[model samples]
Target: MLSRTADHLFWMSRYMERAENLARLMDVTYQMSLVPQSEEKANQSWNAIITLNSLEDAFAAKYPVVNGENVLKFMVCDSDNFSSIYSCLRLARENAHAVRGTLTTEMWETINYTWLEARGRSFDQLMAGGIADYFEWVKTRSHLSRGVTVGTLLQDEAYHFIRLGTLLERADNTARILDVKYHGLDHGGEEGATDFYQWGALLRSVSAFEVYRKAYRDVITPERVAELLILRGDMPRSLLFCMNGVVKNLDLVANSLSGETARLAGLLRAQLRYGRIDDILEHGLHEWLTDFMDRIYLIGDGISRDFLVPMVEAA
Candidate 1:
């Protein structure tokens, strides 16, 4: 396959997955904001979203405050914010269009229609219509797009690249959400009602709340939640699950030049596979997750260098 086609397919899926994850993040943060708390605590919750995406500078430039209203507008529809849901859907559609012939009709229509609907709604309209509803709409549209792609698109190299993009993006976002929220919450001391609610919100953010209950059949705790999201292979959105998918897809699409990239992905997967949550917490979850994110970035760079567009070294 041409590297150009591969690039577009890879990013189209990535952007779509990113948009859905952003909706999940915003929804959870929005829910947490509704909980009764001090003004400072509420502000901290909203600000955590900004920090999670590393959008502190960009968010500050446009919005004077870090409250719910401003952050929602900035994250949901700010055209200049490349990571905003609006921008993600737009970019996904554009990439899909670039390789229009490569995509199935169902796939193209699903993405194009998602962009069309999303582009028509402004932040004000989203707020007026109920932001939670809009967030659900975004998540539903993303699910539809993925379902269509999986059902309609042939399972070939193109399919492998799309799946790769989704898995890698999911892995990065899962780590980001877990690391940021874990630190932001009061986990250094004893667990309380507030901590329980915060931890439950975090689980629901990744649709892991029920899984947590089933796996432990007990009250939510920092350690069990961490284990569920980080180590449980059965948890669909778990880091381990995402890495497993990444390794499988990389193997399917591997070329002679992609051996190193595949090896890097496998190395990460092996670490997660053999990893224990107790050791991760002992070493410091933040430190461990920081290392994981850095490695994820390296794998992304490797993918670009090996399969997509090769990055040129600075002169």
Candidate 2:
């Protein structure tokens, strides 16, 4: 396959995964808002969602009102915001559309339907009925698309590229969610057992709540949360899990460890495997996560260099 084709397939899946995660994050925040928290706490929830997406300025310009309703509208329906759900699904479909022949019919149909559904709705239309149901629908569709991509696509270069993209995006989002939890806690004071609820909510935001509960048997400490998200190799969305998947895909693409792709993946995977959770906590969790994210970003660049972009001279 051409490097360009690989790049597109990888990015197509990445964008779709990103849209789903953002939708899930916003959904959790919106649901929490409906509970009886102080006005200040509710606003913080909205603010955190905006911050997580790194869309403060765009969000500010459109939703100067900045309440739960307006924030949801701006994030979910507004196409002007580049990371909005509508924009992401549209971009995902467009990328897939360009390579229709390379993908299965189900892959194209899943993403195309997602694009249509998102494009056809107005913010008011969503807000009028069940808000949670709407966000859940978006997430469900995104999940379905990913399932179709994995189940239907052949295990060739196309599938590897898409898998790489999805894993990379998941790694970054997992890192960001960890950082957000630490920051939110440091700034927002503890509310007794409410911290447990909040911590559980954080897990729920990443859809890790049930996994976590099963693993620890109702024990939800901050440290355990950090470990589960960052160090657990079995959890699909964990950083370790993502890194492992990415390395496997990178190896499959480049076909050998001599290339830059192999070297980059090996380096990052080694770091994840060797690093201890206690060490991360002893030194500093936030700084550790920040460094980990930076390395992942570097790995992404390296992958693009070796696989997505040609290394040959421009004759």
Candidate 3:
């Protein structure tokens, strides 16, 4: 495959996954913001929002207050915010446009129509008790596009690259989602009644609330929540599940020159697969999450160096 085509496929899928992740994260943020918070917890929660998106300076410049409404605007509706859902969909559509011939008609239509429909959105309208609905729509649209891609596209290198992007993006997101609460809650103390709600909210943000119940069959606890989100393979949004998919796809896409890509994927998968939640906690959840995200970056870079860059050099 051409380097340009591979790049487009990889990035298009990444953008889609990013958009979905932002929507879901925003949903959780909104829900969490409504609850009573300690001064310390409130500050930590608001800071996590800025840090998670890596937009602290920009957000501070735009809004002096880091309240729920302002954070929602920065995350959802700010066109200048490159990581916003609007920009993600725009970039996804643009990348898809460059490789229109490479995508199945259904795949193209799903994303293209999503981008087009998003054009008519009024941010003000959505803020009036409909933002949650808007976030759900974004998630639904992304799921539709991915389902179409899986069902309609040929299972070739293009599909493999797409899968690589999706899983890597998802792995990064799951890690960040898990870490968002690391500082927001006091983990060393007995589980307070409030801790139960906070922990349950964290699980629900990733759509893991019911799955958490099904897996543990006990009341929610920080340790169990971490274990369920981090190590459980059956949890679709779990870090290990996403990493497992990334490794599988990278293996399928591997070539003689692509050893580094597959190796990194395998290494990370092994680390997560054999990892215990207790180990992660002992190491510090923030540190563990930071390491996971950094490794994901290395794996993505390796893919570009091995497969994507070689084509560029040849051309």
Candidate that would win on TM-score: 1
Runs in model 3 with CA error above 4 Å?
Answer: 38-40, 186-191, 309-315
Q: For candidate 2, lDDT tens digit of each residue in 35-136?
A: 666887778768776776678888877766667877887778788987888888888888899888999999898889888878888887888887778878
Instruction: Score every model by TM-score.
Output: 0.95, 0.90, 0.93
Ranked candidates (TM-score, high to low): 1, 3, 2
Quick one: ranking by lDDT, best first?
Answer: 1, 3, 2
State the C-alpha lDDT per candidate: 0.89, 0.80, 0.84
Q: How close to the true structure is residue 28 of candidate 2, measured as C-alpha lDDT?
A: 67
lDDT: worst 10-residue window of model 2 = 306-315
lDDT of 2: 0.80
CA RMSD, predictions in order: 2.0, 3.1, 2.5
User: Model 1: residues >4 Å from true position, as ranges?
Assistant: 186-190, 311-315
Best by lDDT: 1
Candidate 1 residue lDDT tens string, 1-315: 998899899999999999999998888888877777788877887888888788999998988988988989898999999999999999999999999999999999999999999999978898899999998898899999999999999999999999999999999888888876776654553257877887898898888888898899999888898999899999999999999999998888788898888888999999999999999999999889889989988998888888886666311
Deviating ranges (above 4 Å) for candidate 2: 255-258, 309-315
